[model samples]
Target: MNELKISILGTGDMGGAIATALSRRTRHSLRLRGAQPGSTSALRLIDALGVTEASKEDFLASDIVFVVVPAASIEEAAAFLNGYQGIVVAVSVSGSVGRDGLPSSAERIATALPEATVVSAFTSIWSNVIREPGTSGKTSVFVSSDDDNAKEVVSRLATELGFEPINGGALSMALYAEVMGMFAVRLAMDSGYGRTISFHAFNAG
Candidate 1:
């Protein structure tokens, strides 16, 4: 299989964690970019992960781009990817998108990057959880994308990286995942449930 060239925009906690995880697994090339110039946090993350530093332009050359950034800056991220024709994925840990019958951040990003396949995943689970071994069994990573091929590729990567993939379906369905992230994070913190909580479906007979 051809090595996957993945680019991660915003080397914050989530982005850094993902880069470190991928670095230990695939022979793929991973690039981690800072949201701004001279960001020490990002630099530290890139160094720790042994990944290369990248610019917004580098995203155009990547096979997959993950935005582990804040929602407030998503518009800027989308604008940068507006020129990219690759797969663009958003990783929102704040659960920024809501399901109040409105367009989701994933939808907004897809619209911005019309030439690219946009997806939202890797949000429901905390970055710390990914650091633990064998935690994948109790974790579910929800993924939503309008493009089938893009979703499948992301699913495969998630699996290879030791995550249980949950196809939440079309990009619009990301609203639900985003909301669920809110509950999950809150519960993890307040209820002292740790970072291993996940959604499980059962037959309601």
Candidate 2:
């Protein structure tokens, strides 16, 4: 498989896990960066995997951009990449939701990067779930986007990263996916459940 060039805008646990999953499953070349100033550690980590440590310019060159920063930082980050015409997929891994259960920052991102295709994905799957993969284990991801091409791009990427992509479709469906992540994270953190859980589909028919 030809490598997909991915740029991850954050290099925390979630970002790192996503990069690792992509590296393992697909022929992907990742360019990772951190929102924090002077992220030497993040640079070093991704570089060790033969992934490039990217600056703002390098990120803009990617075929796909993963925004993994907090909701508050989404606009700022999006604004920083105003001219980059690429696929921007926001992963609301923070599990924080607003009044409508939607990721509070998605609208800002969608508006700021008007030329970019913004899709919501990797929001339902936890960071820890990607850290460890078991035999026959699977992570379910809910994806929402108005652009069918962008949705397909995310869906293919999700499958490559060992996840089952559930096409929730349209940006409006983001609320459900974001809320699901919140509940999943809380369940893992507060309850006895481990850092991961399987989202299964059972047809009653």
Best by lDDT: 1
Candidate 2: clashing pairs of residues: 3-27
Q: List residue ranges in candidate 1 displaced over 4 A.
A: 93-96, 99-102, 133-138, 200-205
Clashes of 1: 0
TM-score of every model? 0.89, 0.89
Write one digit per residue (lDDT tens) for candidate 1, span 47-66. Answer: 67767787767788999999
Whole-model alpha-carbon lDDT for candidate 2: 0.76
Candidate 2 to truth, TM: 0.89
lDDT of 1: 0.78
Off by over 4 Å in 2: 36-38, 93-104
